[model samples]
Target: MYTSTPFNIADQLPKGLQALMYRAQGAMDNEASGLQRRSFLKVVSASGFALGAFPLLTQAQAQAATPAAAASALKPTQQPSAFVHIAKDGTVTVTINRLDFGQGVQTGLPMILAEELDADWRLVKSQHGNADPAYADPVMGMHLTGGSSAIKNSYTQYRELGARTRAMLVAAAAAQWGVDASSLRTREGVVIGPGGKRLGYGELAEAAMLQPVPEKVTLKDPKQFRIIGKPTGRLDARAKSSGGQSYGIDTRLPGMLTAVVAHPPVFAGKVKSLDDAAARAVPGVKAVLRVPLDRGGEGVAVVAEGYWAAKQGRDALKVDWDTSTVEKVDSAQQLASYRALAQTSGALKYNADVSPLATAPKKISAEFVFPYLAHAPMEPLNCTVQLSGQGADTKAELWLGTQMPGLDTLAASQVLGVAPQNLKMNVQMAGGGFGRRGIPSSDYVVEACAVAKAARTAGLTAAVRTLWSREDDIKGGYYRPMHVHRAEIGLDAQGKILAWDHVIVGQSIIAGSPFEPFMVKDGVDATMVEGMKEPYDIPMRLSVHHPKLNVPVLWWRSVGSTHTAYVMETLIDEVARSAGQDPVAYRLQRFGDKHPRHRAALQLAVSKSGYGKRTLAAGRAWGVAVHESFNTVVAYVVEASVKGTTPVLHAVTAGVHCNLAINPTSIEAQIQGAALMGLSMCLPGAAITLKEGVVEQSNFGDYQVPRITDMPTVAVFIAPSADAPTGLGEPGLPPLAPAFANAIAKLTGQAPRELPFKLA
Candidate 1:
């Protein structure tokens, strides 16, 4: 009952592009070693010619009796959560269950399964799975990937799938040898019998398909893991390192043109009218496509043959924009609006009444504000799409680096008027994502599809459209909202915290977007309270969220905690000052009584940093901040001195996350990376405000990130955590601003709350 079906998809590809997939090899002489059943070979030798190959799936065709492809015509544009393939040669491949924006999980996650399956690590590969409902996030509605849930969400399911595959192979081997299944056991790339009979994983792969899926298969005990705990280099590192990797900018299809877009000078503005005659006359210009804002939000864009040409054409064209809505949208206005709103009783409320303040009459009330922020990832947004007409291959192919591929696919499909399956999205390595790339709406994808559709009429097939010059991305509309917190804390004379009331006012980031269902509720946005409420064992506390007067906001690197943690930790420092207590001691006392993990991190940071010790420079002081985010706890001690009134940081000592999929080394690298990113935001990185609207700081030059010169000597200590691997990428970022602010406050008798601290 064994059958092998072979069909060629090469004909569907361009002339020189053969199928990218191939079969792995099995042991030739050793029939019983079971080694053939476990190993997915990287290279196979046949007819004296050695071929190096990797797992490449070219969409398998269903067998005669299996579910017909048409019957299973899943709306590919919808979104998929999980889509994996197991080749008959023991090769295993998984679509990216989540997005990768340089967090290294695109390589780390597949390693999790290979570790469990005991598959040859080198041979395992992955692909970008299109969005579908089946791939929907268990927690979120659709197959969306954000909120540090990539590994956490897929932990058990990926292992189960791998284990199930292994069990089938074992069963197939048992049937082949006419032996009881109990006699066989799987090891690294092999299955062994009681009498020493063994078979390779590849040899049993085809036969394994005939076996029924095991009702249940035992997962490996953590102690028995071979590859899961071992540190493996990134699977895509070589390709990226050698400059062989193809990013969205490298996407090329037959006759595909290039495109650039001209958006409004301000956010939420409408294009009144534009003349594209001059743009259309450009040498490479094909069509001056007018992209309208009516479909989704605001602004109009122009399409051209090449990005530079599009830019040239855009500059040459004349247009008038209705900036009525944008005129009232300034940072100061937003801040004041949020401040007033924070005083109101919002639809969603927590820690509402300040009755707790009565218990301790000497309460502290402070207002903290964090300005709007931009996710200036290195690679700007780019998408390449190729769309054919209805009944004329109605499919569109997309190549881009997006944290929200599922959403991108769905949006692209909607614009193209095709099913999701008709759209193929190649998820590329993001130069950086940092919450910005997880845009729920596929605005960029839609724009690319629109450009491609227009180009198709002129015989253009492969068109790539890129958005964002450093100016464009920095001034981009989706922003980390300017947030204001009106926080009041009541403390007894002895500094024993009694009550806490925190009210955060900011734009409703999720109110009307695709993420609204999970993010917005009762006028409360969860992101607004992420780090606003302490996990401390406070006697009485209330956290509240107040929506702004209809302004736009989005998630930053640390999401809500990007600002909330700063407010919470800085306010705690103020409380310590009022009580005449050491800042570290106060946090330790409070956290020790409430959260052991938080206390553990805080103590480790203090102890390792030599807290209370004098630095080489006189008038220099140190301040500490501890925050928990993305399930990882982190603490920082920033040592600084006041140059005039501005604080110049000299060194940073941090005791942060230890739970990791890889090891302490990788964890430290991520922590360091996040620390630098955090510093930039707190220093010269926040978006500036002007009379017109948000002004462009423009790239890393004007909107400076922490460079080697700006960076301090950082010491990272990993508090050993046996807990499940928590996120180390973002948690380190939340504490940097607060620690720096607290340090400056100690050096000078001023509690600096406003970000980008300037003493003048």
Candidate 2:
């Protein structure tokens, strides 16, 4: 999904060229260290061609500086599109700034640019970008992919890149023909001249490379778009389907050793004693050394020839963990504390006078508890690191599927004792991340760098690949914070909300993060209260209490909306039911004129799903919910049944208003994937709990994700619009659980207050 924010791109060259320059300088430095000078120019010639295609600097100016001096002058203001390459074969390769990670961005972003470039779809291809300053999110000015901001932030930038490249190609054609550039027009990679002369983009590529870059170019009107709103298949879909795609876990480097760490059961716990004799004696075990862990802890890393040997060596290792300095958190105790805290308002966020609640004719009080959830992406976390040289000459290179590659690069540089400029990050395709890969701490990446550094200190010269088993990933500390919500609502005879008082208790996801100062304000984490009383007009008091627990918590798929939407939507349904009004009508009436997108999405789902017109079968009911997150609105009309006390979702029809759809096929897939994940949260054993400060669930056997049998039939529909695209990855998720819960509540005459529903 794309973000809807604009960014600046006028001050520099692309990072690919800068990286080439750096490599050139490194080659010179390696020669000084008694190493034979490698052919750096040949190594970067392909990327140099792409960069040179965009005239950031004239030939004279570029020739004036030595390669090393030019490298030093390359800064962080570079634009990403400078690397867009038009190959001699007519293949237009556009490098994406964000990780694809199964989100279809590899194709969706290129679709935007190719649409404007008027390139033939068959000749278009895309590649993953590295952790370079040029790849930073335009609005955030950082390398990040969370909040579904990829497409929204880069839509215009990429379009302009295409427009500018087209303008240059036209200019080049005009110079060759001795005519005004306006006499030439492009269509499907061909420059059509006034006299009917035609030239393929491939024939004009070299000349286009020499033409001056235009400062501005007119973007095509939405009405003229031949690709932006079209449904296009993903470019990597065939590769992934044919099992030819490589993810982070599939990364392999020559002379690379695999490592697995034995972390303390309790977070931030230190090793009291160690016995690595058995580990070291294990066959293929090259080294066993203690390394610093994330969140201020220490762990033992067993480096071996392969993953199996590393796991075997890790299993053989024994160490006494010291937990005296860390707080022991038990899930049962924490829930009790959260429950008690939710009973009273802690810090006031929205202080509406809910004094009318006591005098209202109708009142409802509800308390909802949501447990911690692990990201549990299909591919477990893994990072491969290779270090060269030492001191200031030390250069580090990392290969991983990172959501924030630039941040990870900086973090890895610190861990490897190298300057950030000396580090290179190769972003790989990720199986799935949700929000786990975008952590502010860069925990997994830092840990991998630590293991590589430890191996280097242990006299090992090979690259180190740090891998986490499925068990290790589940037991990993970062999780969605457990939350408890208390709500008191007063409604009139017509189900109009008079006053609503709500209190939420959870650990702050951004409290200790570098984003804390900006994301947290006035004793409240903005994410903690995002979806409360939204998309509908209401007077309410919302407060929050963030407890400092030992459990490490991070944002899940939709952040706070994962829990908030369920609370608000389900409760609103209950209020409508109590007043004897139809849920959809009640919601529509309350939507009021301010939220047309919300009303449109809801109406579309209802009309298309036949929610009000078609009668459900016996024991099944209609479930409806709408929510806006990441600036996109999604509404779900679902059919659900309580099958012998277990809720079974039969089918779902989604109406999404992301403004403009780049690739409707990709949007549909994202919604289906997100919906399934949302349903996973309601399944039994979905919670991540702690006992004596240790994660109780280790793998799929204990921690449950949705199985094939649990998948519901889903249909997706997009609301028509020419507005810029917002986020699609997360908005599809927030409404799913609430819609399901609303149907179950209708069937059982009970409003479930906690996750992993226990109707039996």
Candidate 2 lDDT, 1-760, residue by residue in tens: 3211101111232455335434433432333224221332232234432542321222221232245323433332233234477776778888888999988999999999898889998999888777655566766666778888889888887887788678878988899999999878999999999879998887777566555555557999899999887788899989999999999988888988999999999999989999999999999999998999998999999999999999999999989999999999999999999999998888878988888999889999999999999999999999999999977889888889999886687678778888765777888999998889988799999999999999999999999999999999999889999999999999889888899999999999988876666667799988888888887777899999999998899988999899999999999899999999999999989888988999989998898899878988999989989988888999999999987878999999998899989999999999999999999989989999999999999999999899999999998888888898887778889899999999988888886789977787
Segments in model 2 whose C-alpha atoms lie over 4 Å from true places: 1-49, 52-81
Question: How many Å off is the CA of 282 in candidate 2?
Answer: 1.6
Model 2: residue 588 alpha-carbon error in angstroms: 0.6
- How much lDDT does candidate 1 score? 0.64
TM-score against native, each model: 0.84, 0.92
Which pairs of residues collide in model 2? 2-151, 2-152, 3-151, 3-152, 3-153, 4-152
Q: Which 10 consecutive residues of model 2 have the lowest summed lDDT? A: 2-11
lDDT values for all models: 0.64, 0.83
